[model samples]
Target chain A: MFFLRRSLATSATADALAIESDSGSPAKEFKIMSGVILSRPPIITPEQTAFSKAYYHYQSELYKRMSWTFPYWFYYPKGTLAENEYTRVQPKLNEKDPDVLFNRDRNSKQDVVFPPRSVQRETEESARIYAKIVPNPRTTIADEENNIRSLERKLDRTLYLIVKRDGESLEWSFPATTIESGENLESSSTRMLAQYGGEDMNIFLVSGTPALYYKDVYESDGKYEGAKIFYLKSRIFNGLFKPQKESGIVDYAWLTKEELSSYLDKQYWRKVAGALSKQ
Target chain B: MAFFKPSFGTDLRRQSTAFFQCRSLHSSAPQFKSPVSIVHPVHHRVRYKKSILHPKYQTLLTIPKWDPRSHLFKPQAVQPSRVKTHWETTLAPDLMLANYSHNELKLRGRKHQEWDGSSPYHVNRPLRSPAGNAMATPDILPRTFRTVPFVTSIWVNTFNHRAVTEHAERNIPSTVMIQQITGVKPAPAYSGVSIMQWRLRKERNVGAVVEIKGAKKDQFLATLVEVVMPRVKDFQGIANSSGDKFGNISFGLDPEGVRLFPEIEGNPDLWSGITGLNITFVTTAQTDPEARLLLSSLGVPFYGRERFHNVPNLDGTKQTRKKGVVYYENSQE
Candidate 1:
């Protein structure tokens, strides 16, 4: 115990610094920030090229032709309502006519034919089953007006949220916030987003770790170190963005990757090009 | 693949007599584009160029589908698949970022060891098994762009007790049921061991098994997640601890649940006592937790206590248990 005490005394040596810290140097201090790259995924299937359309058609045709003939008796028994409807609608092929080929050699047509409904009032299930479906228009009002803030503008491509700060001279960038002393990048980003972005939006941060990071330099009153921003990926499933008046966010717009290049500065876009989705 | 790839294929190996009843020698219409001509009973034997069979091509009797010069070579990706598009456009980037670890260490997999070679008997001896009762688990490789998980294939199986106790032909429905659901022909499953209590003999047909991959596998998954699972009454979802540690997550559907499939649901009367179906999603992930994450992201729900220990905890404590070490945590916390 006496030897240990002596050793401890000898080690202001090991535990304490031998020299004083230099406080007079003018080294820059970087301000850490977390940037959220919030994006809305495609809501609809993308338009196919001519080659793909033709290929799908050809494949479907091939499948239809190669498949075995459908078992008609299984669905339409001897004297069922479906059988009656089938018999009434579809006529039997004449055996005498050699030119009539669909029934004789190959039964390529396998789809069941239902009798046109006019005389009989069908049940709710049957009516719903045979109801003619009318799909909504692909282009919405948002697309026509060229609304950049509208989430519904681009239905097929991923749309990212870019914001302009309160000042008029400020540049366009993704929603970003300065990290607090004890806060991590993800939590700080989420907190800033919720504080300004309002509770209307339902967002899911993709991960805890940042996907990417960007470094910068600043010269204000002195040669100051600019912000070192870490980008965290997030996705908005469904909701509207309510930009707060006092939250320093002047305006916000949802833009595709292609449109982002034109809105954002060349330097900023260069650093962000790798993280943004092309589609 | 053989059907669509072959440009001039003679798939007339099994021509029904009724199909060949037409008394004409004229060729049929352009029914299937791949087949150049259909063989008739009149000309039962097909004649072809004898040069293909010659020893010139290094005696590669099998058709070289990869060779561009061969008729079997088909240009791939003629049509854009919905599943493929989703993976590329929406799923891939998000998954990569979500599964990324800030600081992960690469672990060496426990491999088979060699003898010290000190004795003379070690000359031609085989490598020894891994140490202890634990299996040679795969290396916990850090997640990277290329290491992201995906479903490689799906194993669909159905075992019928009637096939063993009753006549062996009872497994016919099982085979047909498996084929109907999977859209792929299945192979018969035979019992390896004889059970006296069950009256099952070795080599007896017990079930049917099919491994679905490529396009059909995606299609089956889509149907299961979208239509079948939603229709299942009071379903509790797949159990959280369902994987076999080797990244293959398996689950079974009761006969009623199996019948809920659109393929089987259409005609339930025909399949009165259909056996339950067991589906195993074989994935590229090396561990169970990673496999579970991939599956859950792909729309499969997990219920019960989720033990995501197989995957390296990135967000939370990140205290990964070392090999041969017992982990303890106070429940009071």
Candidate 2:
């Protein structure tokens, strides 16, 4: 019993030391220190292989829906502030003159105090592609990646469209839609853009990637239990932003990054940062 | 008449004897026959009053003869009972006359409706009535009064004396403690005011605070109400007067009370010294009473006026009621 206890204690200490050493030292150093030994790889069973395949399959499906990429437009324009066009000239008074001192009371009574004009912060000119995730089951991972690469190559030539909601506040969001049956990711994205930005607008995919993955549990018990959104970056090749009213878009703005930051939430900024960091 | 009434001792003995006799009789015998059988008499019947019809009035039987040639044929315009006043025509006319236009009043109302003190957009304007006069009236019912009050946020503030004493002692432990208790990261609180004697400087890191909301707030409140509060010794419940006028209530807990929390007590090694916590509960109730009611429903016990003292009657007689202790005398005995 004493020998068994000693062996157990040694094994526990070894495990703890192994964990500590694993974190502190590099794997190569640890291997060299421990004296490297070559051994045959363990034989994997058919069941294990199948289980791993199934796990990957589930992960790929989640990846397809969750991964999103949007084009980051970085445009900073340098320009002097427009002179206060509404500034009015005031009558000057000389403090050294005796007459000015005699008329001080009258001047004080005639003083008309106008509220100070609000100072507007100068903003930089930059634009961002408001891309949303639209999952396409038909498109393979390789095909999606290839499409995004193709889109990235055409980024400079494309003119992206902005969609806005028709309301007092003029809320804006990206043109996003789910991939319909038999539609690929590229086609679905183009369709959503065309539907919101009008068919006249010559829009092309600038770049596309599974940039952001957001899990949305719309219904817990339904067949489509949850949805993953994949954001794809796109830009307009040529055409003006003519918002389709039928699709609930009333207005659009070609704003800079600074201006866009004021309009978008913190989450959007975080997403932008993530996309930019990848680049 | 006083002498005729039985003495107290004799009356007690009589009642006791009667009770014992009744008990003894029940134990002495079990009757074969059924006891207290209820009977219905065959002749018993309920007779409702019969209604008698009366002749209709002569005037009701005949309709007035219509004459096309009469002056009644010419329709006369009826005057309106209530005229549209200027006050009715304009939306909140008194407010408009007082330089508060309809737009301004609406803006203020909207601001108040969405007012959560933690938000930077909250405007600190006094609540006013439709007449443009500041509403000094207490307990004004909100337009959207709900049965259940919503907890806006739970703010936890604590000053770390250990940090002050040992400059090397950072707020790491305090931050960890707060995180463990609230399940959210705590923000470091800086001293806004400086005190020369206390060696405190403005913007000096003195403590940490965490504002909990949503599901986490509910969970923290449940732990506070169910586990921590019950374990505290000599707890007389929270006072009703501990609230800001705008339905926010802040209460301080001593080091002992803080120690009573399961998170702190369960893992003593995790926390070396107990720090007093000031927990402020921001609620959506307009008045203190409403907030108190809301908190009480959420399992926070409140101390009533009678909780502390047993006052004498106006006649200078000693009241039988005792403070802090409940007595239940068995009347059967």
Candidate 3:
């Protein structure tokens, strides 16, 4: 009887172990519970509690003064209404060629026609791309080994294509450009190189998500206007490059990481370095 | 006199016999000299004899102290003179060799003594080598390992009221609200460009703003996550897709939602009108997923999909309709 009981206990323990290993459901539940249990308890001051009571009273009074209306179509799936509207009016809008609408702003009497603010204004709908072009890999075994050795030694040596901005003063920067509407990141980067880089260059997209930059255009009256820049990376398979003067690139040079530091600010260089190292 | 002399002889004989017995006992018993010998009393040593196999085995297996063959396993003794000039005799001569074969063999192995593309371990060989052409191989991007999420700063802004009328009401309440919420005095924001529609003029003070950082930022976030957000009615989690693709996520709160804060809710008389606020969480994470994970770990809820319900359409057809309720995954479940 003792042996029988011992066997039963061992089997039960084994079954428990099997259940623990076989199914992830229990573990997931435990994780969620742990997350909540591990969080620090909130501390509320007496004054805060009093304030909340007063706020609730104020909100009640405000509610009495105003009647609320529920938003229409809150439960409808996305694109249903837009699809219906598009089917109804698309033919008429298309006949006129919608591209003309953009040009009409140029002829409008108003000097500046600000685009209508989007309902969601936190992030831009359109994504930007930034590219870092690296030199081709060495072909010979010895050269490759040397490259590896240098990298192991933390002796980073790479050439960066820096362009001179044609502004109030000549400011040096990497070959970066904003992605145009209807064009993808890779194509935009290639076009930017062709236009500003000055020379025929072959390049391919390097793996990794683009680095993001938030440039605050203006900050006034508690309103902030900003642009998001997505930085990407690419390797120049073949290219003979020169800086173009017509594109505001008066001068250009292949500079090492250390040399690039002297030309670019710390923040700007950090972004460039991030894209390069991502390769 | 004869009797006394006879007794003295007998006494002498007895004394000699006792002395001879003492000598015999002393010679028979083992004498110990070393301090450790105290542990092995003479009687104990006699009872347990030393095993003959122990010393025989030890002698057969033990390597000699000065054997050069054992130098690989044991540490080599360094002479002060040799240590001072060994680099000149060894390292310099190895370095001076034109081919570097000796150094290569020592550093790598015999297999890598000669430069061959097919060497099992080449310095430049890609880790987990790809099955195709080497030149066509993709480069490995560096991974930046970030451990903790930190709030860099919090920015609060309000709009300009000058465009409504010449006697347009100034946004004093908003400025006071920001000050009350942040516990810091707000600075006036100026317009950089002139916009005719909004009647915004360049260099005109349009709104008030306050930037909170360090410990104050932590306090504000605690209030936001623990006190304010949970109290919001019909509150769904922040959209999972929200973020600047980078680590920063920016979300806006309506005037109604902003009113839930204790700072705003506590003072009924101080509130004049509704003022909206934009809160941006800046994290050290490089990607949106990482940032969202970090935020969720901090107790900020995120909604997966918007909740939907069945409703009758205008044409008397039953249709599936969405409700304002966002389906939030109860992470604590």
- lDDT of each candidate versus the true structure: 0.72, 0.46, 0.45
- Which ten residues in a row are the worst by lDDT in model 3 chain A? A31-40
Where does the lowest 10-residue lDDT sum fall in candidate 1 chain B? B324-333
Docking class of 1: incorrect
lDDT tens per residue, model 1, B99-202: 66646667566667899999999999988777664556677678788878789999999889987777878888889888888878899987889889999888
Candidate 1 lDDT, A1-279, residue by residue in tens:
001011111112111222233786565566667789999998777887898799887766645544555555655687888767766777565456444343332544344465577536778886886689997777899999999989988899999999999753599999887776556665688888887788788998777667778876675734335667778788998778889868888889999999999999999899999998888
* Of candidates 2 and 1, the better by DockQ: 1
DockQ of each: 0.19, 0.01, 0.01
Ranked by lDDT, top first = 1, 2, 3
Which residue segments of model 3 deviate by more than 4 Å?
Answer: A1-279, B1-147, B160-169, B304-333
Clashes of each: 0, 17, 9
Across A162-246, the per-residue lDDT of candidate 2 in tens digits comes to 3466643455444455555555444566776666657775643422223234433433332343344455444344555565767
RMSD of 3: 41.9
Please list, in the order the candidates appear, how each scores on TM-score for chain B only: 0.74, 0.49, 0.45
